[model samples]
Target: MDVFDHDAGGISGRRPLVEIEEGAGFPDGLTVDAEGCVWVALWDGGAVRRYTPAGELDRVVTLPTPRTTACAFGGPGLTDLYVTTARTGLASPHPLSGSLLVVPGAGKGLPQPAFEG
Candidate 1:
């Protein structure tokens, strides 16, 4: 498994092929675009950050709730993004977690091939 430092605080030291930028947050889910941009969903931070292929900060998208679980590219043209969020904490007041979200995405998504065996 490959590991990248994305703490974004003052944590120093180089590890492997990945390096985190300054002031970034904890990342939970991640997806790569056709242009090689990385979109990371912050677990507790309640937002997503887009990074360039070279590790530069590009853009950020905010979410309505906290605890984004995962993300992926879907649809026929792959121009749509699907985000999954979790509502881990609750006493049964309202339907919170385990919800699906769809949003507009940039560029085209390649078809995912089925793994053989």
Candidate 2:
């Protein structure tokens, strides 16, 4: 996966600031924290990885299910990390597969901005 920097003109010309190898499992979804760290959900890897703004791996949180799909921060002060998983391809589903997990005190996250159309 790659994160890019757009030029002043537009997205027509841009360069990727971070390029992660495909061997690192598919990145399904991600969210940026208040500290500018990125939390990424790994599908088929059963884990979520936190990456620093410099593209360095900071931390990893593993889940019981391999099909972890998405994640977000919620609850009071956005100090909780909520993860979502899937059981679509599991031969023997894990007890928590396809469930919503609330991990308290994961880290502080920035509140999502409301769309202004």
Candidate 3:
């Protein structure tokens, strides 16, 4: 994936920021944490990975159900992870397929900033 220079008020350019390993499943939903680390959901891989801002793989959270489609941080303290999965094409899906899973104490999420636009 790449991060682009967008502070100029236009689509300036982009530079490589990270590379997902081969066979690590297609990169799906992702969000930046409070620490600027990236949390990505891996489709067909049954896992969520956390990468440092420098693009280094730092942590992985595995799930019993495959086809993880998206993830986000939620909960009162914002230290919980809410994961979404899919079971549309699976011949036999896990019991938790398509259910929302919560990972407690994952990490703090970036606070939403007020839009000035």
Candidate 4:
């Protein structure tokens, strides 16, 4: 968990911004693409969500596994997306909850902006 401290002009300590449902799982991993789109890996929900800068749901990518862990954009020009997942618990009529995934996307992701002084 990482957070920005506006007053300090640097990244601050960990802070809980949003809490997922109990047992539903927390947000696994996240990354901001070159286009400024935020891609988040949803645990248990088995999907990745791409959000616009305005906090709108631009796209949702479903996964074959049930636990989508983290996501990032990589490859030439940052045009490819890579995702990771965890299969901690799966069996006994439960859904598969762990695996890594990838998908082709449009636009290359940009580097994150540095904290202002």
User: Candidate 4, clashing residue pairs?
Assistant: 33-110, 34-109, 34-110, 86-98, 87-98
TM-scores for the candidates: 0.69, 0.85, 0.90, 0.68
Instruction: After the best TM-score superposition of candidate 3, give how far the Cα of residue 68 lies from its true spot, in angstroms.
Output: 0.8
* Residue 20 shift from truth in candidate 2, angstroms: 4.8
Q: Give the local distance difference test score of model 2.
A: 0.86
Of the candidates shown, which would achieve the greatest TM-score relative to the real structure? 3
lDDT of each: 0.68, 0.86, 0.90, 0.68
Please write out the lDDT profile of model 1 over residues 13-117, one tens digit for every residue: 544434444444467788888887777777765566677777777877777657777778898789987778877774542254567777786444557788999
lDDT of 3: 0.90
Q: List the residue pairs that clash in candidate 2.
A: none
lDDT of 4: 0.68
Screening candidate 1 with a backbone cut-off below 3 angstroms (N, C-alpha, C), the clashing residue pairs are: 87-97
Candidate 1 error regions (>4 Å): 1-25, 90-96
Which stretches of candidate 3 lie above 4 Å from their native place? 113-117
What tens-digit string does per-residue lDDT give for candidate 2 at 1-117? 466666777654345545556766688888889999899899888898899988888998988888878989999999999999999978999999999988899999888878999
- Candidate numbers sorted by TM-score from highest down: 3, 2, 1, 4
